[model samples]
Target: MEKTYLTTDELAKKIKYDCRTIRERLKDSVLIEGVHYFRPFGGRKILYIWEVIEQDMRVSGHGFGIPMANGEVCHG
Candidate 1:
């Protein structure tokens, strides 16, 4: 399957979030590295996998809890 890769700005536009929030808040929190996004060619630039992110977004619940490393929420 072909995955759609999107830049931070592009993802912000599609997800209706400010680019800064995605960078500082979601980048390593809700949006994980290597799963949701990755730096291509070991470069600093990050590309997000749309399919993976979209799927997770659909199932992520709303609550106050810690976000697990594997993208699952740990309600404590």
Candidate 2:
């Protein structure tokens, strides 16, 4: 399967967040490293997986459902 890689800016646009916010706030805090993003060829360039991020966003709730090690799943 061909992988879709998105830069911070592209990801920010897709998620409707600012690039700076994605880097400073979401990068290591919520988005995580290997799971949500990756450094290609050990370089500083980071690529985010859109499908994973979208899936996470759909599932993440303010207060709800099953509590996983990473986050909560929405019940309704």
Candidate 3:
């Protein structure tokens, strides 16, 4: 199956997030390696897998009493 791979800037545009935020904040914490993105040829370029991320975003419930940037998990 051919997957939809996206560049960091392309992902930022599609998701309405700043590229810097993705690289600095979301890359390792929220977005994971292999599943969310990959380094092609094990080189320095990052390519995000859009389908996996989109599906996870729908299920993760990110803003609904979830974990916050300051390392706090909101419990209802």
Candidate 4:
């Protein structure tokens, strides 16, 4: 199946976030490398998997807090 890939600009527009914010804050923190995005041909350009991102966002939290890399959820 052909998946929907979106550029940083395109994704920012769809998600209503600034491209800079996505690149800096959300990139490695929430939007993972292989899971949410990938660089074609091992290049510097990134393309976000719209379907995966959308799906994850729909069920991201449980009224808890930030997800940690160590498999812990911090409630605030």
Candidate 5:
């Protein structure tokens, strides 16, 4: 399958979040490295995998108390 790689700004636009939030907050806290995003060719540019992030976000319930893959929800 062809992978869809999105830049921080593109991901922010798709998810309706600020690029800064994605860069500073979501990068490592929730959207883990390698799984959700990565530095292309080991460079400084970060590219996010839409499928993985979207799946995690959907399962995350957007902080709406929805259950995750591990049967947990965000309480805040």
Candidate 6:
């Protein structure tokens, strides 16, 4: 199956998140490299895998804790 790859801006639009937030808060924390995103041709351009991201978003965080902006759960 073909995968939907998205740039940072496109991902931001689709996910209703700011590009800066995705870059600073969610990039490495929630959206993991290789699994959720990647740099094509070993270059600086990063493309996010939409399917994986959407899937994870739908099934994230079963335990009790407030989801923080940085992707870490706050116990308090």
Overall local distance difference test of candidate 6? 0.82
User: 1-76, model 3: which lDDT tens digit per residue?
Assistant: 5689999999989888889878877787777898799999999999999988888777866632344568444645
Over 6-63, each residue of candidate 2 has an lDDT whose tens digit, in order, gives: 9998987876778886776567767888998999999999999877777777786542
What TM-score, to 2 decimals, does candidate 5 have? 0.78
- Model 6, range 36-73, lDDT digits (tens) per residue? 99999999999999988887867764322344855785
Model 4 clashing residue pairs (backbone): none
Best by TM-score: 6
Give lDDT: candidate 3, residue 15. 86
Q: Estimate the overall C-alpha local distance difference test score of candidate 2.
A: 0.74
Candidate 4 lDDT trough over 10 residues, lowest sum: 60-69
lDDT, candidates in the order shown: 0.81, 0.74, 0.80, 0.81, 0.75, 0.82
- Cα lDDT tens digits, model 5, 1-76, are 5779999989878888788867766667677898988897899999899988777767866532422455344556
The TM-score between candidate 4 and the true structure equals 0.78
Candidate 6 segments whose C-alpha is farther than 4 A from its true place:
61-76
Q: Estimate each model's TM-score.
A: 0.79, 0.75, 0.79, 0.78, 0.78, 0.81
- Per residue, candidate 1 scores C-alpha lDDT tens digits across 1-76 of 8999999999989988789867866788788898999999999999999999888877755432454457555765
Q: Name the 10 consecutive residues with the lowest summed lDDT in model 5.
A: 63-72
| Alpha-carbon RMSD, each predicted model | 4.9, 5.9, 3.1, 4.2, 5.5, 3.5
Better of 3 and 6 by lDDT: 6
Residues 1-76, candidate 4: write the lDDT tens digits: 5799999999989988788867766788778999999999999999999988888877855332454557555655
Clash pairs for candidate 3: none
Better of 2 and 5 by TM-score: 5
Better of 3 and 5 by TM-score: 3
